[model samples]
Target: MNKVQSDFLSLLENHRSIRHFLDKKIPDFDIRRIITAAQSVSTSSNGQAFSIINVTDQEMKKKLANYAGSQKQVEDCSNFLVFCADLFRLEQISQRLNVEMKKVLDSTEMFLIATIDATLVAQNTVVAAESLGYGIVYTGGIRNNPEKVSELLNLPYRTFPVFGICIGYPDPNRIPEKKPRLPLGAVFYQNEYPNFDEVYPYINKYDETMKEYYRNRSESKREDTWSKTITDKRKIPRRMNMKSFLEEQGYPLK
Candidate 1:
């Protein structure tokens, strides 16, 4: 294969989330370079409505670990970063320019742009961290209690926590297995989404593959096929209240 194709295949085939981490600390220069790479991502309209808070304090990491669904990686990892979607900077700019901030903050389109900006930045950080030999995990559970996370991080109005990322050296003793993904044909469609008639067979095979993967990799032997996992999560209504939580956090979503 060509070099680009070889690297792309390596990246796709080897990507795995590492939760168990060694006690070693990552150096400050590497952290700075990784974050610089993250900041190099293209932002929406160059607004750059995102910021990352590096949490190095042990006490704060402990508290954040609790905030993020009691995930031990939050405390055990060498570094923790809270990625935030921030409109507050633009609001400040508006004040300095004597322009109205209300119009920008109230628009749903602006909110989406800010969210996209944050997500892009976080993903860039993940890739950069991985390339530098650091293992990383994205903690979506940071939003399990948005208010609590905001309070812990001292987030100002118009800035919301998008997610937390933990980065560190992986513990050699606890090597994680590479998780399987759906076949490319299952997700890719020409010009439109594939109909169920064209997709269900692939999904069924994928479900079996996932089941076998879980059986081998997990000690708990969780009977979570892809479809069953999706059904189980959707059946629970708790994650649906995220809209109200976002509104409460000053998104306004108008």
Candidate 2:
């Protein structure tokens, strides 16, 4: 491989979500650039149906942290951004332009499009933030109680808070070590898809690698593997009431 390819691959390989950060604020210019990177990400049909809210109010952060399962990072980070799937913006534009928003707004396809757009843009922001020496952690617990979160953010009917991201300069002392991932054999496929037998072994091997990772973490070490962790996670129905929440937000999922 060429030097450039190797260096870029190394950056991709070393990614770890930063939960603990120094109490330093990111500069406004850098924040703008990071958000620009997010905006630069391609969207479905160029709809750009997503919006971000940067929560600067400390009281609001504290309230959001409590709402998001008490994740202290939400309150402690230099910047906290809520990425929302926003059809309301487009709805207003359609109304101004004399277009029929009803044709798109109330469908499952619109929900999927907004969700994909929001997630992709946020992921782009993460890479850009890391490139500029900032640390970040994405919190999906923002969905724990969506109605209250939506109300707190003053979201319109056609909007839903998908996730929250905390950004800041990394605290050198609190940097987390990178964990292992599943092998290519488990994830990548050529022309045809491999059946379970070919992929199952890789998952087992990844579990072994994750066992070491969990055991060696600087804080909150555990005696579990990737498989066990996933199993335990699945035992509980995560986001069981999200349907009702989404319905409340004007997405009956029809």
Candidate 3:
């Protein structure tokens, strides 16, 4: 590979979710640099329908941590960014121009667009932060009590917290080994989707790889295959109120 390709791939392959952070604060300039890099990423229809709330206040972070299933990383990181899929700004623009957007805003497609936009921006933010030598972990636990989190952050209508990212300097002693990923053959395809019989081999191979991974992990070591782990996780329904919550938040998704 060329130097640029090799360097970028190296950065991506080295990623591991860091839940432990040092007490040092990230510089303001570095924060701005990370956000700027994130903003430069592509947005759907050039709408840029997303907002990021950077929480640094200790008290606020503490409350957020509790709301996010007591994820201490939210409170301990130098910065906790809540990425919101936003349509409120679009509503404002419509009001200013004397146009109607209520119907459009209620469409499921629009909701998907905003959510995808926010996710894209957040991924870019991760890349930027990691490039600057910062450790980061994404917290989907924020969705456990999205309403409470929204209240704490004072979020307006037509917006929802998709997830939060905890970014800060890593505590070297706390870093863990990177988890294994499924084989590319299982996930990648040519044109048509492959038969299950063909895919099962790849899945079985990955299951063994993950079984080993969990067996040797430093903390919370467990003996489990990836398939079993995922089945156990998904068999139980979670966040069943999300649809109702989204409707209440002005994303009726009609």
Candidate 4:
């Protein structure tokens, strides 16, 4: 990689999901730039099927905080945003242009396209926020009650809240330790995917690294390893009703 590319990557490698925030707030100009960066992300067939709702109303944010795993960060952060898969917006456009709807919003590929668009927008927004010295936390708990999130936002059909983001200045005294990740070999395959046997050694190495990380990365250290954590979490189903939720949101997802 070039020097600039390497430096940018070094920045990305230091990313952490900050849950606590200082009393400081993000500047309005920076917020606009961050969103502009999000808008710059590529979309499938230029579908641009994503929407973001900034939640600044105190009472509403608190209600959302309650729904999102009761994470105080939702209300505590300088800014909170919900990214949504928004085929409804495109559907409106198609109507204005006198287009048919049957093959557009009802197909499984259409759902995938919209969801992917929302994800890319959020990911780019993260990069932009980090570049501006802001800390961000992505709340998967937004899905803990998707129906509530949608209802609260008054989102139309063909729209789904993918996740919420909390953004603010990081508390100096509350900086979190960076968590370890799986080693490159196990995840960064080349021309072909490796079999389980070939990946076992890298898994063992990563497990050892994560064991050390969890033990020393915090004041209240825990006993855990990468492989063990994966094994434990993999067996449990999460968001099992997500399929039904999508269907209810007007994505037949067929």
Candidate 5:
């Protein structure tokens, strides 16, 4: 295989979210370089409609730890960052350039672009951290209390926390295992989506494999198969009022 292909496969094969961290600190220069790598990602329209808040305060980290399902990584990690979908910068630029902020921020296209930019940068940060032998975890639970996070961060209108990330040296005692993924054929298709006839059998096999994996890995605490887990999750109502939350954050979703 080509070097690029080999490296990609290695990264994919070994990927896991690290929740346990050593108590050592990462150097500030290394932190800057990691964020620089994240900033190198291709941005939508070169607008770069995203920002990251570097959070290092112990008290704030403890609060965020509580907010993020009591995930220990939040308080134990060397660094925490919140990636934001931001139109606030664009608004400032429009004001400085004597253009209308309304012309840019009042579009569904702009909102989509901002969200994509934030997600892309966050992924890049994770990859960069992994390459540097650092453990990292994404905290989607930041959105669980979006208003509270916004208030804590003093975020202005037109900017919202997309997610948080924790980074640190990996703790040897709690090394995570690679989680299984669905077979490539089950997800990727030639052009149109593959029919159920071609996909269902693979899913069934995968479900059985996953059940065994969960029983072994999680000590049977989670007995349900992947399909059952998804079904159960969907049966319960999620914090589905995100549109109202966005509106509160001044994103009208126009």
Candidate 6:
């Protein structure tokens, strides 16, 4: 591979979700450039049904930090960008052109389109920001109180806050060690999905690797297996109100 390709892969491999940030500010030009890079990502059918809210105000950040389950990173980061799945823009455009879009906009397909579009753009933004020497973390906790977040940001109909990205200079002293991922074999399948029996070995191997990773990490060191950790985290029914919340937000997802 060429030097450029190798360097890019290295960057991706070295990524760590930075929660501790320095008290610094990102310049307007860099923010714009990051968005530009993010926008270059492909969207669903060119609908581009998403929007980003860059929150920099101190008071607003505090409220957002609370809404995001008291995640201090939401307030500490120089820029907390809320990536929204937005059909509101399309709705407005269709209305201006005397076209009907309400029925289609409320479809499950359109909801998927908007959600996928926002997620694609957010991933690109992460890559771009990291390339520029900034640290970043995705704050999915924003969805814990999606209604409050939408209200605070003044989000309109047919738009919902999907997730957020915290971008800023990393606190060098507190930067967490990179965590290991599942074995590729456990995730990748060829023509057909592999049988559970075949995948179990891969999972077992990964569990051992992760157990070591957890025990040796710089902070929050613990003795735990991947399966136990995942079960403990996911077995709980969290965010059960998201369906009703989305319906109220004009995404009935019919």
| TM-score for candidate 3 | 0.98
Error of 1 at 163 (Å): 0.7
After TM-score superposition, what is the CA distance of residue 101 in candidate 4 from its true location, in Å?
1.8
Best by lDDT: 3
lDDT of 5 at 220: 31
lDDT of 4 by residue, 93-129 (tens): 8899999986768999988899899999999999999
Candidate 5 regions exceeding 4 Å error are 2-5, 218-221
TM-score, one value per model: 0.94, 0.96, 0.98, 0.95, 0.94, 0.99
Candidate 1 per-residue lDDT, tens place, 64-121, comes to 8997789999999999999999998999889999998797697899889999999999
Q: Clashing residue pairs in candidate 5, if any? A: none
Worst 10 residues of 6 by lDDT: 175-184
lDDT values, one for every candidate: 0.88, 0.91, 0.96, 0.90, 0.87, 0.95
Model 5 residue 1 CA deviation in Å: 2.6
Clashing pairs in 6: none
> Every model's Cα RMSD, please?
1.6, 1.3, 0.8, 1.5, 1.7, 0.7
Model 4 has an lDDT value of 0.90
C-alpha RMSD of candidate 4: 1.5
lDDT of 1: 0.88
* Candidate 6 C-alpha error for residue 195, in Å: 0.7
Clashes of each: 0, 0, 0, 0, 0, 0
Model 2: per-residue Cα lDDT at residue 145:
80
Clashing pairs in 2: none
Model 4 spans > 4 angstroms off: 1-3
The candidate, 1 or 3, that scores higher on lDDT is 3
Model 3 ranges with Cα > 4 A deviation? none
